[model samples]
Target chain A: MVSVGQHENIEILSHSEVEEVAGFVGNFKIKVRRKARYVTEDLCTGCGLCQEKCPAKKILSEFDAGLGTRTAIYLPFAQAIPRIPVIDRDNCRYFEEGKCGICAKLCPRGAVDFEQEDEFVELEVGTILVTTGFDLFDCSRVSQYGYGTYDNVLSSLQLERLLDASGPTRGKIVTRDGREPESIAIVHCVGSRDKNYNRHCSRVCCMYSLKLAHLIKDATNAEVYEFYIDMRTGGKGYEEFYERLQEEGVIFVRGRPAEVVPHDGRLVVKAEDANLGRLLQVPVDMVILSAGLEPRRGAQDVAHVFGLSRSADGFFLERHPKLGPVETASNGVFIAGACQSPKDIPDTVAQAGAAAAAAMVMMDRGRVTLEPSVAQANVRLCSGCGECVVACPYSALQLVEGHVEVDETLCKGCGVCVGHCRSKAITLLHFTDEQLLAEMQGALRVLEVA
Target chain B: MPEPKIVAYACTYCSYPGADLAGTLRIQYSPHVNIIRVLCSGRVSPELILRTFREGADGVLVLGCHYGDCHFVSGNHRTVKRVAVLRRILEYAGIEPERLRLEWVSASEGERFARIVDEFTETIRGLTPIEQVLA
Candidate 1:
C-alpha cells in the first residue's frame, strides 16, 4: 500500500474491515468488507472543490487532534493517499433527507456516487503483518489532570499538535484565551510510571517533552519548568539533549506536579521539590501533561482475532523476547510500534523496519513449513464430542462436515487437544501416543543398556 | 532393587547451566536424575510432567531461573503459577503433589542445584512408589 501510494496509483478502500481469516501462513484467504465510502474512489480527484460547495462543515476533525474543524466531505489528512474524500453519511445532506447533492453537483470529476454499495473482497497473501499501533492514555480517567474541566490543561499529544507548526494556533504556544504568558509548566509521567495507571515508564515522553520545551522556548520565550520524578533520557543523543536544554537555562525541577488549580485566570501547579524538601506553587499560562502510552482499545479483541497472547502489561507477547522480538507466539503474525511496548520514535521505527523485514523474510520463503506436531483427527475413533475443539488454544481444531478437522498452520503443537479427546480421536503428529511411548521406553532402555 | 527414576526439567538459561556447573565442579549429587533442558520453565507444560510420571518416573523436578531473574523477564512467573495449579491438579488425581516440585536455581548456583536434587531425591525416597500411587 505504501509503494502504491508513492506511485499515486493507490486505490484506498477506506472504511474496510477483515470479516474472516481462513487458511495457513503462506496461503491465507482473508475476507474483507469494504463499506460504502458513499463517494467513488477511482473518479474522485480530491480537488477540495466539492468540500467548498458542501454546506456541512461543522464536524470535528479527529485527524487534526480534534483541535480543528473539518467539513463532512473532506480528506482525512493532507497526505491522505488516494486523495479521495469520504462523505460523513450521518451528517451528509442527501443521506439525511435527500436535501443536498451540492458535492455531486460541484465535483469536477463526477466522483460523488450515492448509489455505491458495500464491497466484499478476498485477498490472498503469503504473510500478514500487524502494526495497529497504540492509543494515548485518556487523562480524563485520572480526573486530577482537569483535562475536560479546565481548558488550559492539555494532554502531551494535544500539546504536540498545539506546539506543531501545522496546529490550530499556527505554531503559537498560547492558551485558549489567546495570551502567551511568561511561565509554562510541563508535567511528566501523567498516566505512566504509576501503579494506579500504567506502571511502565512510557520511554518516549521525556525526550518529546524536551523537544516540546525547546519548541515552546523558541516560540513563546516563556520560562519553561519541567517537573519530573525521574529524568529518563537513556536513548541515543537524549541525555546530551537534556543537558543542552539545562545549559540553555530550562528549570529542571526534581519533582512531580501533584495538582493543577485554576487561580487568577492561570493554572497554578502545586508540587514538592523532592531535592529541596519544600512545596512550590508555580503559576503558568498553559500546562502540557505528558500522558503515557496505553494498549489500543480493541487490543484484546485483536488478540482474540489473531489467536495471539498478551503479556500482563496488555501488550502483545513476543514468541521470545530476545530471539523473536517482532514475532508473536502465534506464527505468521508480527507486532511493531507501541503495540509491543512503550518506545521512542527511533525504537518504534527500528521495530517497524524489523517487523517489515520479518514479514518480507516469510514472504520470500513462499511457503512456511508447519510443525509436524499438529493435531490430527482420527475420524474412525471420532465421537464428535467437540471437546477437543474447545481445548485447542490456537483454534486449530474445528468441526467440519460433522467431523473434526485440524488446521495445520494455526496449531502450535501444544498437544492440549490430544489430552482432551475422550475418544482418543485427536493425536499430535510428532508427539503421538506411540512416539511418546517409544521415547519413554528409549529413555528407560538406557538402564538395561548400561 | 531399581534406582529411583527422576526427571529434571531445567530451564535453559539458568538451571540447565547450573547443572552443567555442578558437573564441572564434580559435585556428586545423584546419578538417578535425567535432565531435560527446556527454553524456560514457562515452556514446561503440565502434560510433560504428567507424562513423565506415566512413564514410570518416581519424581519430577522443574527448575527455573530465580524470581525476577528470568532471562525472558517473568516467564518464570507464569511457570510458578502453572506449577502451583498443576500441583493442585496432581493432588486431586490421587497423586502426592510432593512428587512434583518447582524451584528457582541461577546459573551460578551449582552447589544449590546439588542440594536441591539431593533433598528432593531423599523426599521421593520416603514416599511410596509412583506406580503404587497410580495403581
Candidate 2:
C-alpha cells in the first residue's frame, strides 16, 4: 500500500465511494465521491501529537473493535495507508458545542480544514474489479452465545485486539475484572452452518481459532477448550498447526454449544460432546465466540451500481464457479476476496490476483465480442404487452414505443422473454421453440423403447 | 399407462452434474426419470412444463442448485416463483398440483439427486395419469 501510494503512476483515493458508474466494457466512466476528511491529507505529516492531547478520548476505537477508546481526531489505526487522521465530526466538541479545538491548536503542521467539502472524482477505466471485503457476523445476534450479555464473553475480534502487542492491555489475556483467566472457552461456528443463521460454513474460522488458542496458551497458559462442529483444516499446513495445538494441551470438544450462561460469576457453556455422547457444562472465566464472516454491509448497493449480481448467500456471484471464478455476470466487472465468499488470506489474495489479471486481460484485448446467440425482438409482431420486459432477468428488454427492444450486450440469451411473449415477437437466436421442442422429444424418446 | 413417463428438467451446473455423479457412483434409481439438461431450472418456463404434461408425461420435476448456490446468482429464485404460480394455476385448472414438483440438488449431492428422482416418480405413479386427468 505504501509503495502504491508512493508510485508516480498510481493514485490512491482514500475515504471515497464509487457513486455512479456508466458505459460498457473498456469504456467505463466512474464517478467517485470522496468524503470530506476535515483534514488535509497532503499537509498533515503523520506526527502523533493531535491524537494524544485531544480532549475527546471517550469515543470507541473502531480498529480495536470497540475494545479500546480513541480521541475524536485520530487515524483509523497506526498502520493505516497514508497514515492520515480523520476528525470525528459527530463527537468532536468543536463541532457540537463549539468549545474544544485542542487537536487543531496542538498540530505542528496546521493541516486541519473545517470547511473542506466532499469532492467528486471521475475516472475513465477499461475494466473494474470489486474487492469490498467482508464484515464479521454480529455475535450478539446469536443469543445463546451470550456475547453482549456476559461481560467476560468477547468476540474473536476483541480477543485479537487484546492479543495485539500495542493493544490496550499490551497483549494481556485478562477478564473484565482485570485478572488473568484460568480457563477460557472458544466457541466456534457462531452464526455459521445453522438453519436459523447462515447455512454456509465459514472456511477460515477453525484455523484462526486454533491460532488464537495457541496465542492464548502461550501468553497466559490458560486451559483453553475449543467447541466446534467440524475442524475444517483443509488448506496446506493447516492440519499440522491443529495437531500442534492439540499437542500443546488445548482441548477440542466436537460439538456446537447449546448456550452460554453466567453462573456463579463465571460463564457456563452447555454443549453435548458428539464423540462422547454426553452433555457437559464447563464453567470458564472468559468466553470467546469465533464469529463467522458475512457479506459487507451495503454490498447490495455496490453490486447494483456495478451491474453485478450477488448469490443467494449474499456474496457477489461469479460468472462460473469452476471456469471463471473471479468474473461477474457483467462483462468488465470482476469480484474477489471475502466479498465473494468467506475465504482465508491466501485464498483472498489468490482471487484478488485472478480478478486483477481478468481486468488486465480485458484491457489488453481492447474489445469484447457479443455472443451470437443473443435475443432479438420483432417490432411488427409486437402487441405492446410488456410481459417479456418483466420476464427478462437481465433487464435487457424494454418496451419502447409499444415495441420490445433487446440490448444485445445485456442479454444472456436465456430465452425467458420468448416464453413470456404472448405474440411470439421475441425469440432467442439459437434456442427457438422448435429447437427446444426437438431437444425435449429426443430426451423423452429413450423411455418409449422400454 | 405403462410406465407413467416423467420429464425432469435438470440444471447443467448443479442437478445435471448430480445426475452424472449418481451414474458414476452406480446409484440405482427409477428409469422413469427422463432427464433433460438446461442451463438453469429458471430457463424451464411454464410453457415448457405444460407442453411436457400435454405430451402424456405424468409428472414434471424441476431441479436446480440449492438455495444460495445458483451459478446464475438467483436463477433458482425464478424457478421457485414460476413453479409456485404454475402449481396454483394447475390447481385452478382442476389438475393435481402434485404432478409438478421442484427440488434442489447440488453437484456434490448424488444420493440426493437419485432420491429426488425416485420420490418424484413415486408421487407421479400415485396420481391419475395426465391423459385420463385431462380427458
Candidate 3:
C-alpha cells in the first residue's frame, strides 16, 4: 500500500469517490468528489501534536473496528498514505458549539482549516481499475452467534485489531473486561456457505482461523477450540500450516457451532462434534466469529457508475471467468481483489497485478478496435417514428433530420433497436436480417432446399 | 428419425461462451442442438423463431445473460419480454410452447448450460417433429 502511494506515476486520491462517469473507454470523463479532510495537504507536516491536543474524543474509531475511540482530528491508521489526518466534523466540538479550536492552535504548521469544503475534481483518463475491497459481513446478523448479545463474542476483524501490535489493546488477547482469556473459541464460516445468508463459500476463513488460533495460543497459551465445517487449506503451504497449528496443540473440532449462549457469566459454544458423534458444550471467555467477506455496502452504486455487472453472489462480475478474469463487460474498466470475489491476500495481489497489466495494455495501445457488428441505420427506410431511439439501451440511435442515425462508437451491437424498429430502418451489420435468416435456415437444414 | 434438430440462438457475451466452457469442461450433452451466436439475445426476434420452426427446426432455444448482468445492459430485459409474448403466439399457432425455451446462462455456468441443452433436447425428443406439427 505504501509502495503504491510512493509510486511517481500513481496519484492517490485518498478519501475520494467517483461521482460520475461518462464517455467510452479510452475517452472517459470522470467526476470525483474528494471529501473534506479540513487539513491542508502541502502545509501539514504530519506532526502528532494536533491529534493529542484535540479536545473532542471518544468517537468510535472505524479503523479499529469500533473497539477503540479516536479524537475528532486523527489519522485513520499509523501508516496512512500522505500521513494527513481528517477532521470528523460531526464529532468536532468547534463545528458543534463553535467553541473548541485547540487542534488549529496546536498545529505547529497551522495546517488545520475548519472552513475547508468538499472539493470535486474532474479528470480525463484512458482506462480505470476498480479495486474497491470487500467488507466483512456483519456477524450480528447471524443472531444465533450472539455477537452483540455477549460481550466476549467478537468478530474476526475486532480480534485482528486486538492482536495487532499498534491496535487498541496493544497486542493483548483478552476479554472485553481487559482480562487475559483462559480459553478462546474460534468459529469458522460465520455467515458463509449457509443457505440462509450467503450460499457461496468464503474462500479465506478457514486458513485465517488457523492463523488466529496459532496467534491466540502463542499470545496467552489459552485452550483454543476451532469449530469448523471443513478445514479447507487449498493453497500451497496452507495445509502444512494447518498441520503445524495441530502440532501446536490446537484442538480442531469438525462441526459448525449451533449456537453461542451465556451459561454462567461465560459464553458456551454448543456444537455437534462430528468426529465424536456427540454434542459438546465448550465454555470460553473469548469467542471469535470468522465472518465472511462480502461486497461493499454501496457496491451496486459503484457497479452502476462503472457500467459493470455483478454475479449472483453480488461481487462485480468479470468479463469471463477464466480467459478475461480481470476485465469487465465495460471497456477499459477492470476489477480486482475481493470486490470481484472473496479471495485471500495472495489471490488479491495476483488479480490486482493482472488488472494493472490489462489497464496498461489499453493505455499503451492508445486506441480501441470497435466491434464490427454494430447497428447501422438506413435513413432511406426510416420513418422518423423514434421508436428505435426509445428502445436503444445505449442511446446510440437518434433521429437526425427525420431519419434514424446510429452512433457506431456507443453502439454495443446488441441489436435491441433493430427489434423495436417498426420501419425496419436499423440493421445490425453482421447479424443482419438476411444473414441471420441464412444462419437459421442452415441450422434447420433447409438451406439446401432454399 | 435421426435425432431431432434443434436450433439454439445464444448471445455472444454470455451463453455462447458458456457453451464453449461446457466443451472445455468436457461435460457431454445432446448433439442434436446447433448453436448460432448472436451479439445479444434481444436480436432473436419472434419472426426469426417462427421462421426457424417453419423451415425444419423441432425446437429453438434462446439463451442470454442473467437479469441485470447483460453486457449490453437491459438486452436480456428485452429478450425476456419478447420471449414471453412469443411463447403465447407459439401456443396459439398450434405449436408446443415448450419447443421454444428462453433461459439465462452466464459465462461461468458451463455445467448449467449443458444441463439446460440436454433437458431441452429431451423435451423436443418427446414431441413429434416440426414437420408433423406444420402438417
Candidate 4:
C-alpha cells in the first residue's frame, strides 16, 4: 500500500469519491469530490505531536476496529500512506464548542487548518478501475451472538486488532478485563451461509479463523475452540495451515453455535456437536465472531455513478462470471477485489492485477473499435418529439434541430428507442426491424400444431 | 398432441448465455423452443411478439437479465414495462396471456433457464395453438 502510494505516476486521492462520470470508454471525464481532511497535506511532516496534544481523545479509532481510542486529529493507523492526520470534525473540541485548539498550538509545522472545505477535482482518464473492497458484516444485527451486549463478544476484526503488535494491547490475547484468556471460542460463519443474513459463503473466514486460533495459542496458549459448519480450507497451502493448527491442539467442532450467553462471569457458547449428535455448552473467557464480508454500504450509489450492474448478491456484476471476471458491461471500466465478490487476499490481489492489466490494455490502444450495432435515426422521418430521448437508458439520443440524433458512443444497441419512436424513424443497425421480423418468421415457419 | 413451437428471444448479455450454459450443463428442456439472440431484451419490440403470434407460433418467451442486473444498465427495465403492457394487449385480443411469458434469466442461471423453458413449453402445449386461437 505504501509502495503504491509513493508511485511516481500514481496520484492517490486518499479521501475522495467519484461525484460524476461522463463520456465513453476511451474518453471519460471524471469529477472527484475530495472530502475535507482539515489538515494541509504538503505542510504536515507527519509529526505525532498534534495527535498527542489533542484534548478530545475519547473517540474510538476506526482503524483499530474500535478497540482503541484516538485523538480528534490522528492518522487512521500507524503506517497510513501520506502520513497525514485528519481532524474528526464531529468530535473535534474546537469544531464543536469552539474552545480548544491545542492541536493547532502544538503543531510544530503549523499544518493544522480548521477552515478547510471539501475540494472538487476534474480529471480526464482513458480507463477506470474499481477496487472499493468489502465491509465486515455488522455482527450486532445477529442478536443471538450477544456481540454488543457482552464485553468479551468481539468481532473477528476486533480480535485482529488485539492480535496486532501495534494494537491496543500490544499483541496480547486478553479478555475485556485485561487478563490473558484461559479459553477462547472462535465462531465461524457468524453472518454467512445462513438464510437469515447472507447465504453466500465468506471465502476467507474459515482460514482466518484457523490463523486466529494459531495466533491465540501462540500469544496466550489458551484452549482455542473453532465452531464451524464446514472447515473450508480450499486454497493452496491453506489446508496445510489448518492441519498445523490441528497439530497445535486446536479443537474443531462441526457446528454453528446457536448463541453466546454470559454465565458465572464468563461466556458460554451453546452449540450442537454435529459429529457426536450431542448438544453442549462450553464456557470460555472470550468469544470471537468471524463475521462475513458484505458489499460496501454505498455500493448502489457507486454502481449508479459508474453505470454498472450489481449481481444478486449486491456486489458489482462482472460481464461474465467465468469468462470476463474483471471486466464490467461498461467498456474501459474494470472491477477487482471484494467489490466484485467476496474473496480472500490472494484472490483479491490476483483480480486487482488482472483489472490493472485490462485497464492498461485499453489505454495503450490509441482508439477503440465500437460495434456497428448502434441505433441510427432517419432524419427525414424523425418527428423529434423527444420520446426516444426519455426512453434511452444510456442518454444516447437527443433532439438535434427538428430530428432525434443518436450518440454512437453512448448507444449500447439495445433498440429500446425503436419501439418508443411512433414514426419508425430510429433503427438499431444489425438488429433492425426487417432483420428481426425475418428471424421471427423463420422461427415460426416450421411450427407443429398440437 | 404434437409438440408446441415456442420462439424465445434471449438477450445476448444474459439470457442467451444462460441458455448456452444449460446446453453446457446438459440439462434437458423441451426442444420445441428455438432461441434467438438479441442485443438486449429491450430490442424485442411489441411488434415482434405480435408478429410471432400472427405467424402461428404456439408461444413467445422474452428473457433478459434480472432487475438491476441488465448489461445496458436498465434495458431490462424497459423490457419489464413493455412485456406487461403487451401481455394485457394479448389478453384483450382473446389470446391466452399464458402464451406470452417474460422472465429474468441471468448468465449464471443455467438450471433456471432449463426449468423455465420446460415449464413454458408445457404451458403452451396445454393452450390452443395461435392459429386455432385466431380462428
Candidate 5:
C-alpha cells in the first residue's frame, strides 16, 4: 500500500472523503472533501524534526489501537506513506493551550503549518470501486467478557499491536504491570456466531486466534489455553497450523466461555467443556478476546454515496452472490474486501482484483446491458389515484400531470406498485401479470398431476 | 377424508428459500401446501389471495421476510397493512379470518418455516373447510 501510494501515477488522497456522487455508470461526477491535516502537503518534506520538538505527547495513538502514546504532531504509524506527520489540532497544545510553537520553531525546512483549513474538490470519472473496509465488532458490548472492566482482557486488535515489535512493550508478551504471564487464555467468537450478537461466523477469527495462540506460547513460553465453540480452519495450511499448535501443547478447550471474573488474585475464565460435559474455571494472568468484524461505521452513508444496497447482514449487497461477486446492484460501481463481508486478507485481495477488472471492462466497453425488468406506468389506462406512488418502495413512481411516471433507472421492478394499483395500470416490464400467471400455473402443475 | 388444500404465497427472496431450506434440512411439514413464489410479499394482492380461497383452498398463507429485513426495502410494510385489511374483509364475508395467515420467515429459518406450516395446517384443519362453507 505504501509503495502504491508513492507511485507517480497513483494520487493517494488521504484524509479526504466523497461528499457527493452524481451521474450514471459510464460517466460520474464526484465531489470530495479534503480534510485539513493542519500541515501543507506540497511544501513539507517527510521529516521527523517536528515530531521530536512537540511538547504534547500523551494522546493515545489510534494506529496502535489506543494501546500506545504518540506526540500531537506524529505520523499515523512508522510505516505510513508520505511519512509526513499531521498536527492533531484537537490535541495540539498550540491549538489548545496556545503556549506551544516548538514544532514550527524547530523545523529545519519550515514544513509545519498550523493555519490550513479543509478544502473541497470535484472530479469526473468513468467508474467507481468501493473498498471502505470493516470495523471490529466492539467487544465491550459483550459485557460478560469483562473486556473493559478487566485490565488483562484485551481485544484482538489491541493484542496484535501488543505483540508487534514496534508496539508499546517492544514485542514482549507481558501483563499490564510489566510482569510476564505464567498462564494465558484466548477466548474465541466473543461476538460472532452467538445468535444474540452476530449470526455468521467471522471467517478469519478461528485461524487468527490459533495463530495468536502459537505466537503467545512461543514468545512467553506461557501455558496458553484456547476456549472455543469450534475450530474451523478451512483454508490452505490453516488446518495444519491448528494441528501444529495443538502438538505444541496448547490446551484447546472445546466450549465458549461464559464469563471472565477476578478470582484467586488472577482472572479466571469460566466455561463449559462440552466434550467432557463439565464446567471448568481456568485461571490465567491475561486473556485475549477474538472479536469479529462488522460493516464499517458510516457504512450506510457510504452506500448512499455510491447508490448501493446492503444485505440483511449490513454488508454491501452484491449484484449476484456468485456470478457478480464484485459488481454491486448499481451499474459501474463495485464493492470489494471486508466492506462486502467478513473475509480474510487473501479473499479481500482476490476480490479487489476482481473489482478492478470489473471496472475496467465497463470502462473499455463504454456501454453495458441493464436488466429489462423495470417498472412501466401505462398512462392511457392510468387513473393516477397515486396508490402506486405511495406503495412504490424505491420512490421510482410519481404523479406527473395526472398520470404516474416511472424513473427507469431507480425502479427495481419489484411489482409492489402493480399489486397496489387500483386501475391495474402499472406493470413490471419483464415480470408482467401474464408471466406471473404462467409461473403460478407451472408451480401448481405437479400438485395437479399428483 | 381428503387432505386440506393450502395455497402459500411466499416471497422469493426470503420465505421461498426458507421452505426449500426446510426440505434440505429434512424438516417435515404438511405436504398439502401449494407454493407460489413472488418477487415480494407486497406483490401478493388481496384479489389473488381471495381467488385462491374461492378456488376451494382451505387456507391461504402469505409468508414474507421480516419487517425490517424486506428485500424491497419497505415492501413488507405494505404487505403487513394489506394482509390486515384482507383479514377484515374475510371476516365481513362470513369466513373465518384464521383461514388467512400472514407470517415472516427468513432464508436461514428452515425449522421456523416447517413449524409455521405445520401449525397453520393444523389450525386450518380445525376450522370448517372452505368448500363446505361455500356449499
Candidate 6:
C-alpha cells in the first residue's frame, strides 16, 4: 500500500497469502498463494447492475457497521481498489443449487469465472513491512456498559460511523430505537487505563471523544456530556480543541463512569465528578462508549508468523523507539499503525510512511547486508533431532529432505538454537566460541601486561 | 605486579560515550579495563558473558544508558532480564555471579565510570582468580 501510495513501481498481487519466507536480508524469496477472486479484474466495470438482480441479499456486510445489510455477491467496500464485487460461493444461489447463473448472465463484461483456482506465486524482495493494523477493543467484554444488551449503547467506532454522512443512518443522529436523542452521554476509557483490561491509556480516545461530543451537538442539537477521568488532549493543538469544545457548551464531567443502566426507556449513567467530589446521575437517550485499543486477537500468532517481538502491552516491539521507530528487531520486517502502539490517524499515517521509506530504501538498494552473526549448520554432525528447528524463534532452520538448512536471512543470532543442538551442528558467526574466547583472553591479558 | 583485568561491555549510545568522556577528562582509573562496545546492553548475549569467564577474565562489567534511557526505549529492559538470568546461570555453574556486574551509566557519568572501575578492580583483587573458580 505504501509503495503504491508513494507512486513507486509496485505490482500488488491482491488476495495473496504468504506461505513461506526464505533466504536472508538482501535476498528473500517469498512464496504466496493468490486466491482467485473468481472475477477478472481487467474486465469488471463495477457498474453494480449484476448486484441489483442477485437473489441472495441477506449476508452480513463485514465492512459495514453491521447496522446495514448487503447482498451475497457484493463489493468489499465502496472504495475497494478493484471495485469488483466478489461472489460468496456459499451463498450464491447457482452454487447452492447448480441452477441459477443470474450473476453470470447479468454481468455486462462477463467478469465472473468460477473455474479459477488458487495459484502460487513467488517474489524476491529485499525487505518486508508488516502493518497489519489493529481491531477495536470489543465493548462486548465490558458487559456492565450494556453494549450488547442495550441497542442505544454503541462503541466509539460505531458512533463514528453513526455520525458520518456516509454511514448507515445517513448522518442522522438517531438511536437504534429510531428516536432522535434529546440528550447524549459519552463515556471515555472503556477498556483502557484499567489494569484489569488494557493498562495503557489509548492515546487517541480523549480527543476523539471531544470530537464526537462536538459532532453530536452539531448534528442533533442535543445536550452533550462527556464523562472522562482526565481530558488528556496534550498533543499539538489538541488542548486548544478541547478548550474549544468546552467553550462550545459541551459539558465535561471529570470522572470514569462507574455504571450504565437502562432505565425508563433511557440510559442512566452514574459517575462521580472527581474534580467536584460529587456523585451525579445523568440520563440520556443515547450513549457512546469510547472504547480503547487492545492488541488484536492472534497478535502473538502474527508476531510468530513474522518473527517479531511484542512488548508487555502486546504491541509489536520497535527496533529503537527514537532511531528506528518503524523497524523491528527482526531485519527485513517493519511495523506501523496500531500494531506497534495505539496512535491517532496522523501518527499512524506518519509511521506508515516511515515503514514505507524503510522498505523503499532497502528495495532501492536491491540488497541488505545481514548481520554476520547468523546460525550455521554443520552437515557432518548428523543427529537431525530437529530440536534446533523448534528452538529457532525466527523459523530460520528447516529440515529439507533429510538435512537441515539454515536460511541465513531469517536467523536472528540469538543462539538459543545453538544451545539446543545436542549434535553440536549449529554455530553462530562472528560470536563463535573461538572469536568470543579470543576477545575475552585479550581483555584478561591486562593483568599479565601490567 | 600486574593490575587486575576488567572487561567492560558498554552499550554504544550511552555508557560507551561515558567511558570516552572519562578518558577525555583524564580521570585516571585502572588502565587494566578494556572496553568492547555493543549496540545495547541487551545485545550483550549470555554467550559473550560466559565466554569472557571461560577465557580467564577476572571481572566483567555490563553498562547501559540507564533505566528508561535506552536507545531502543526498552532495550535495557531485556538487559535487566537477561543479566538476571545470566546471574542465576553463573550461580548454578558454581561460579560467584558477583564477578559479573550490570550497571546503568548515562552519557554524562564520566566520574562515575572512573569510580565504578576503581571499586570493581579492588573487589576483583580481593577475590581468587577466575581460573580458580573455573577449575
DockQ of each: 0.08, 0.22, 0.43, 0.51, 0.35, 0.12
Evaluate residue A349 in candidate 5 and report its C-alpha lDDT on the 0 to 100 scale: 89
Clashing pairs in 6: A24-A409, A26-A368
Q: Which ten residues in a row have the lowest lDDT in candidate 5 chain A?
A: A441-450
Q: Arrange candidates by DockQ, highest first: which order?
A: 4, 3, 5, 2, 6, 1
> lDDT tens string, model 1, A380-421?
899888876765545778898788998876776655566556
lDDT of 5 by residue, A1-450 (tens): 788986886787888899998766676889999888877778778778888778887889988887899999989989887777788888989999877889888877776777878899998888899999988989999998898898899988988998999899889988888889999999999889988988878899999998898889878879999999889999888889988988999999999999999986689999999999999999999999999988888998887778676766788878667788998756789999999999999999899999999899888888777668787888999997998888887778999999999998777677789879878788877667777666555544444455
Candidate 2 per-residue lDDT, tens place, A313-359, comes to 78887877889899976778999999999999999989999999988
**Ranking 1 against 6 by lDDT, winner:** 6
Candidate 3 CAPRI category: acceptable
lDDT of 3 by residue, B1-135 (tens): 657888899998889988998999999988888899998898887788888899889899999988887878788888888889989999998999999999999877889999999999999999998898899
Candidate 1 chain B has its poorest 10 consecutive residues by lDDT at B68-77
Lowest lDDT sum, 10 consecutive residues, model 1 chain A, at A441-450
Highest TM-score model number: 4
Note the residue pairs that clash in candidate 1: none
Q: Please, what is the TM-score per model?
A: 0.73, 0.75, 0.85, 0.90, 0.78, 0.70
Model 3 lDDT per residue over A1-450, tens place = 789888998899999999999888998899999998999998998888888988777899999998999999999999999889998889999999998899888888899898899999999999999999888889999999898888999999999999999899999987888789999999999889998888889999999999899889879969999999988999989999999998999999999999999988888999999999999999999899999988899998899889887876889989888889999988899999999999999999999999999999888988889989899888899999998788788888888899988889899899988877767788899999999898887766642332
What DockQ does predicted model 1 obtain? 0.08
Flag regions of model 4 displaced more than 4 Å: A108-110, A377-390, A393-407, A445-450, B1-5, B18-33, B66-69, B74-105, B108-128
Question: RMSD (Cα, Å) of candidate 1?
Answer: 8.2
Using DockQ, give the best candidate's number: 4
Residue-wise C-alpha lDDT for candidate 4, range A169-282, written one tens digit per residue: 988888888888999999999889999989999899999999899888888868999999999999899999988999999999999999999999999999999999999899
Which 10-residue window of candidate 6 chain A scores lowest in summed lDDT?
A1-10
